[model samples]
Target: MRPKLQIACDHNDLAAALEDIKNVGDVVDIIEAGTILMLQEGRQVVECFRALYPEKIIVADTKCADAGTTVARNCATAGADYMTCICSATIPTMKAANAEIDEIQVELYGDWTYEQAQQWLDAGISQAIYHQSRDALLAGETWGEKDLTKVKKLVEMGFRVSVTGGLNTETLALFEGVDVYTFIAGRAITKAENPKQAAMDFQAEIKRIWG
Candidate 1:
């Protein structure tokens, strides 16, 4: 099966987000109202996206560190199909989030180990997002063998994995052999000259590698 394409709208502007969605919505399986967008707009962003395109998967990238249940319920009511929580969250937080929605996705920053991942999987958190830090990338690092290695290990640990962090046309090819549940592209798609064609390009490559 082809890896799902996720478009990340990381900015605060709703008009820009809607424009990108209008152009690329057909090829996108998941639309992530990114952390910035969520914080700035709250449920309004999620509700707006849900109302406009009911068929697409809407993810609330809350990156919840605590008070998981409250956050999860709010996002769900706002029309999120999935919600994100950081792995550093306490067991109670994780469980609370999972209770509200079956599809809680744990975002893995550099701090988490495989043992912690197992605990999350045991808690019924079935999805994992291997996120590359924007700060690190800005400091001049690049995604390479370590990303592939970690992604494969996360899969072995029993979490459906997704990856993000400055992914674009050229860099995305690096993960070809690794199985990913979803590929998240923020500026690469949303900032493109032609958003729909950009999405199609990513989808084409994803199908070639993972289909």
Candidate 2:
């Protein structure tokens, strides 16, 4: 399957996020209601987006920690096809969330190890995210061969992984060895002068590489 392209609208303003949707919604496969947006506007934003584009797959990036079941339920009820929780969230929480929804995504961020990723997979969680820190990006460190190796290892272990953080055309090449299930592009698409064009370009590149 071609890797999915998720467009992250991490803005605080609803109008700006809607504008972004209007621009790129047609090309992007997933619409991510980023953590910041969910924190600011709650389920209303997800509902609005669902109302606007009933056919689009909406991902609510809740980043849930403790109340994973409730968060997942709310997002799913609000028409989110997928919702996210922190990988470090308790196993009970992960299990509870999974029981409530069919397509909840758990992100492994901030010190989660590969062992933990395996545990999540063993617990029946299918989707995961790996991100480079902003500090790492600002320090001019590239996502090295080691990162791709990690992704390959995770894929070999039967987990679908999404690569995120500071993704752009130049950095995207580093993903060659990584069987990335999805590429999460936030500021690269939302902050572009032409958001729609940027989304189209990213989608085109992904099709070229993964299709």
Q: Which predicted model would earn the best TM-score?
A: 1
Task: Give the residue spans of candidate 2 off by over 4 A.
Answer: none
lDDT (tens digit, per residue) of candidate 1 on 80-177: 99999988998789899888864899998868888888889888888999888899889998788988999999887777899999899787779877
Looking at model 2, residue 38 earns an lDDT score of: 82
Global fold similarity of model 1 (TM-score): 0.96
* 110 Cα displacement, candidate 1 (Å): 3.1
lDDT tens digits by residue: candidate 2, 1-211: 7778898888897888998889888888888998888888888889988898898899998888887778888988988988888877987888888887667687866677778877788888888887786678898866777778877888888878888888986677677656789999988987889888898889888877777
- Candidate 2: the clashing residue pairs are none
Q: Using Cα atoms with residue i matched to residue i, what is each candidate's TM-score against the true structure?
A: 0.96, 0.94
Output the worst ten-in-a-row residue range by lDDT, candidate 1.
Answer: 11-20
